[model samples]
Target: MAVAATPSAPIFVVADDHPMVRDALALSLGAAFPGAQVEFAGSLGETLMAVERRPDADLVILDLDMPGMNGMAGLAQLRSSHASVPVAIVSAARSPALMRQAVEMGAAGFIPKFTPSQEITDAIRDILAGAVWLPEVARDHQLAPVEADLALRAAQLTPQQHRVLALMAQGKPNKVIAFEMQITEPTVKSHVTEILRRLGVQSRTQAVIVAQKLGMEPPAAKGS
Candidate 1:
């Protein structure tokens, strides 16, 4: 396999809610890139803020089910806000479908949480060297056309529109969305309208279904 040029002492941001997972990733990253700096975040909001603070971060390893992630929507949000930074999804859910979806949504890599430490380090190395990494099991898995189309439509949403869509998926009404987003009710309604139009869905319920399609509902057997 071809490897991109590697950066020495690269900065990495590891975002996962579980302290143990964060520490394990930190250990792997620190060992792999000696003198590297590793930052931690327990939620999507924090991850975005952390990345915003360090736009030059070489890589970001994110947890899909973390607080404020709203599934792949958070990935879309991060990609939209900081398209330059390479973000990898490191999660317990290892379904090939979810892995393909993450890549479809622009992840640099999808590392299953149970990955061995040395392999994790190697994957991070590959990602830093400008390669897209995925578990061996996901290599030959093809994304369904409908799944790919959903990813494409989801990617079309502006970051704010993504936030509105996430709230709508949670069954939040426009008034509540307005209060949470600190915007006027009419603004929220406008966002909802745009979300519906962008997703090619006519009604809020249909939009919610689209959101759920991009949501974090991995199989019950796939523990998050």
Candidate 2:
């Protein structure tokens, strides 16, 4: 029988806006996965770019509340663009519902920001070994069919369209989205039309409702 090969030094991207949290996780990862290559990002855009630059990275530890995330929308974008790279959610939110939702959305693991460094390391190791990791609080979870379908649709969006839809989900008008995204209003309108089509929704209201399925109010966490 042949033995499978494993990476001797794993590469990781830790994406969090807070410098302290990002540094702390890097330290923990370095200690746990000796000789591991760790990169950092402060927002969803930066995270996406970093992962794009390192598509062969072993893992991505993502922060759910960072800028440009707009809830789990960014996750959909990342998974859409880089299906081969594994992603893990590390958030302050300890909600079992959110954890289960992440798993259903194709996350490799869900780690609470408050989890001890050792546990986080263990979770990473397990995920890298091809196991799905979720906290104990989220063990017996199930997903609604509607939510699963929504995640699937969201993952089909192109990166730019996903960003437009995220802003739209915030109830932003086309002009506002254009200004925020530094694009023209007409372009925003085009994106909206395509977003509605991809989501199989005929109107902006229905599209927002679909976005809301993956939406979340930011959670407050200590030391995060």
Per residue, candidate 2 scores C-alpha lDDT tens digits across 5-67 of: 246888898999989898898888878877788889999889988988888788999998888
lDDT of 2 at 151: 59
Model 1: how far is 56 from its true place, Å?
3.0
Candidate 1, superposed: residue stretches over 4 Å from native: 1-7, 93-105, 136-141, 216-224
How high is the lDDT of residue 36 in model 1?
79
Please give the TM-score that candidate 1 achieves against the real structure. Answer: 0.79
Worst 10 residues of 1 by lDDT: 215-224
Give candidate 1's root-mean-square deviation (CA, Å): 5.2
Candidate 2 lDDT score at position 71: 63
